[model samples]
Target chain A: MDFFIQQIIQGIAMGSLYGLIAIGYVLIYNAWGVLNFAQGDMVMIGAFAILVTHIFWGLPIIPAFVVAIIICAIVGYFVELTSFRPLINSSNTRRLIATIGVGIFLRNLVRVIFGADPYPFPSIFGNTPVKIGELTIIPQNIWNTVIGFVLVFLLTVFLNNTRLGKSMRATAQDREAARLMGINVKQSMSLTFIIASVLGGFAGMLISPVYFVIPTLGTSLGNKGFSSALLGGITSNPGSMIGGITLGILEATSTNFSTSIQASVAYIVLFIVLIFLPNGLLGKKESRKV
Target chain B: MTLFNKVYKATRIWILLAVALTLPYWVPNNYYLQIFCLGMIFAILTLSLNILSGMTGLFSVGFIAFFGIGAYTSAILTTKLGFPVPLAMFLAGVLSSILSLTLSLPTMRLKGMYFAVATLAFGEIMYQLFLNWTAVTEGTKGIKGIPALELFGTSFRSYSKFYYVILVILILIIMLARNLISSRTGRAMLSIRENDIAAEAVGVNVPQYKMISFLISTFFAGIAGALYAHMVRYVSPESFVNAESAAVLAMMVVGGIGSIPGAIVGGIGLTVLPEFMRFLGNIRMVLYGASIVLIVIFAPRGLGGLIERIDNILSGKQSLGVQKKQQHIEGEE
Candidate 1:
């Protein structure tokens, strides 16, 4: 029972990270229907950014965080401007292939820059086990879980109350309709990528404190992002948040309790979700009249 | 391009097959001979994937799973059960094809990127099972000493002999692919790929044709996997990693997705590029990956497609349908 509870709390903490990453996927997916295979690589870039700013340059933690987020957003915006925007006006197939190209290019490019070493980031939370109710988890894990929920809460308010957020949502619903409504479709798309990339970068930075920072750092969370996106049902913000935590915790529990070969768990979870809930947990159900 | 069209059109295929079938005996060095032979098998694997990713419009991330299936099946049947290599290879192909059908039934219902993800999961499951089922698959240690495809009662223990056996298989596969892709079935698959809803509206059996293409492609993968096992004389979990799948997909993309020539040329080009890069020391990998970027961005149609365009210009023939479609595909964006 003690082990199970510990596993559950840790799982929630990890799942919350997945939820954060999944938001990046959901945001771009909503604005533009491409899966942005580079989403993972973007997270990788984020980790690298944090690595360069703090680990390499010996910058303070808070400034490094800001720099990482800004750099990540800028890279995301550049990727959209260079690769995605041109392909957007083309076929979805072309867009997909192009994005995959970006993914391959970015991963390999990072490989060149970072030299494939998994480095340790300085933890903002001191190295200690945080305990609550007979459940002891990594202090960083607890921090991640708490901060993830708080971010989501703020994000929801931003989406509902902010003019830019509503414009982004409007663009997501229908590009043509949004254009008719005087929303700049191109700017909205760019904003979506920027916002998503920044969020993904933030997740990477947060994860780096407790995680292995490497070129393939994002590779581990790649499919989980997709899984959470599916979990969120792709149409709702709350759906994405709930889905991310759910997937992360489920995977953590499975890893802690089930077979130790947990490498298979994420793919397994994805396969099961794809099979059972094709539209995802919070996905809006659709009916056909044809 | 008239050159490609004339070449792809019976006359060219016959000459190509004749040369490929006869080249193994002509090569003097055993290692170089073996490399060409291995290339033949890899070509078949690429061609098999091409049938689906290239012709049918379905991108299979787990394309190599069927190949792994074939390898394991053949390895087990020949080594453990003491069956003949020929029978093992045949049955391996059959089993892999059947497995493809099974996977397709449940997963093919998913569309676009969903299909890609589902196939990836399928590949992972297959890998895990292959690793864990120690009773059958021998765990991570893997089954070794898989017998070679011997013919005329002669075991192909030597590179020279194995060369001929693989050469023959590659030729046979290429011919079969050419004939199959030119048929009505191929047309239906391409139609489905361009737009499934439109194809379905026109009475194309979207699911059935896709399943068939996927199955047939896996059949080829299985055959190649069995050959690869025997060619290396070993079967291990490491041989069938997601990296191998990515390499195969990379070949298909670089060679030109959906084009037969693209698949073949891409296979050979990529297979040879790394070998040539090996001389560049460790920096070879960085340069090699850079080459992939250069090709996709500049000549997205791959080497085969590029060669076809040049051939068109030099010979005064219209671009082949494949080239036009690839151009159309890129142009649509």
Candidate 2:
């Protein structure tokens, strides 16, 4: 029972990280109908930004994070201006491939600057464990869970109640209809990118302490987040969150069996989910108008 | 086709064939021959991928996994089972085509992006299998000392000899691809790419064509993989990573999607050009990524489009506007 509880806690922590990245994915995908494959790279860049500020410049952790997120937003804007805006009228495949280029460029640029070694990330929660009776918990894991839920709740509310969020959703639903409704579709789309980048940056910051800072940090994590978003149904926020947690938990539990099982759990589960629940666990059935 | 066109085409083919056959002599060393072999191998890969991605419009990011499957299959057969290389390569392609069914069938109902992600999942799973299935794959240590090419009492143990084998295979595959693309089945596949629903409504059997496309593409990918395995005399999970898959896609795009000549040009150009840029050191990949973006933005039709324009000019025809208008109509479809 104790081991199971430990696994659950670990899963929740990791799932939250995946969830944050998924939210970014869902946002950009919704706004532009293009899966920004670079979203993962953005997360990696965000973490690197924090590394520069907090470690190199020796800024306080809070200021470092804030500055890093702003840098991420700026990067996101340029990403939109360059890779996306030029190809707006092109096919989705073209746009997606362009994003892939952006991802590779950013990753290599970071490698050029930082070299290809993993750096130790300083943990914000410090190296301490909280004890309760016979059970022990890492302070970082607990904070991660709490912060993850809070952000998800806040985002759900924001998307549900805010005007900008509503406009973003409108653009996602039907770009033409959204334009007809007098929405600044272009501006809305850029804002969607910035917000998504912020989320990606935040995910990066959150996971850095746990995963370390590396040039190739985003590849596997991005893949996991992508799978999470798909498993939850790319169209739904809550679904993405649930999907991440489920995937994380699955990975944690599977670790006991074999390393191979742990590594493959997310993909195998994603494959099964995609096959059986094409609409996703929380996604609506798509209606086509001929 | 006109008599002039026929004469021009025949002359071009003969000249290209003559150049290809005599390449090893004028080349400086075995190193250049090896690189040419590698380029031809990748050309085979890009061409096969084009059958699905370029012509059929299936955006499989996991296509390289099939290549890996073919390589490992051939390696195991030749090394462990003591089978000949040709027989092993054939079986490798057959196995990959069959395995492609497992992926294509379940994801048949998925839309473009979803299908892509599903294939991505399929790729990661395959990578894991290659990494962990140590019994067959030999794990991360990789399989080494595979047998070389020997057929009909001729030994292709040398690089120049091997080059002929690859060139012959590549030309045969290209001919097969060209013939297939100009056929009724190819037309049906193109229609599906333009719009699957519309094609289905018109009785094109969308799922069947998609399956056929997958089978055909993966079959060749497997063959290319077998070729690569034999060429290198080694097999490792590292050779078939997702990045390599992306590189092949870049080749298809750089040459021009949906163009046979484009795939060949893109494949060879991407492979050969990178070797020349070894002086750039670490920044090579960064430039590579940037080039893909620039090409997508500025040269959407890629080198294939440029080649067509050149061809038209040489043939005393004006086709620039006609080409653009055709593409526009196709986009509408």
Q: What's the distance in Å from true for residue A131, model 1?
A: 2.6
Off by over 4 Å in 2: B1-10, B319-333
Name the best candidate (by TM-score): 2
- Residues A1-290 of candidate 1: C-alpha lDDT, one tens digit per residue: 99978877877888888888888888887888777777887888888998999888888988988888889988998888877775565545445556666766677677767777778877878888867778777888888988989988988888879988888889988899999999988887898899889888888888887778887777658667777877667667778788888777777678655573566777777787877787778888644232
Q: Candidate 1, clashing residue pairs?
A: A15-A248, A90-B333, A232-A239, B54-B258
Write model 1 residue lDDT over B1-333, tens digit each, in one string: 455455555465477668766776787677666666666677889999988877787777777788899999999999999999998998999999998876788776677666777787788778887888889999899998787777777888887777777767776777888888789998898787777777899999998999889888898899999988888888898888665776787777777776677777777777777675676655565565545645666665667677677656444465345444433453121
Instruction: State fnat for each of the candidate structures.
Output: 0.26, 0.61
Looking at model 2 chain B, which ten-residue stretch has the lowest summed lDDT?
Answer: B324-333
Question: In candidate 1, residue A52 scores what lDDT?
Answer: 91
TM-score of chain B of each: 0.89, 0.94
**lDDT of each model, Cα atoms only?**
0.78, 0.87
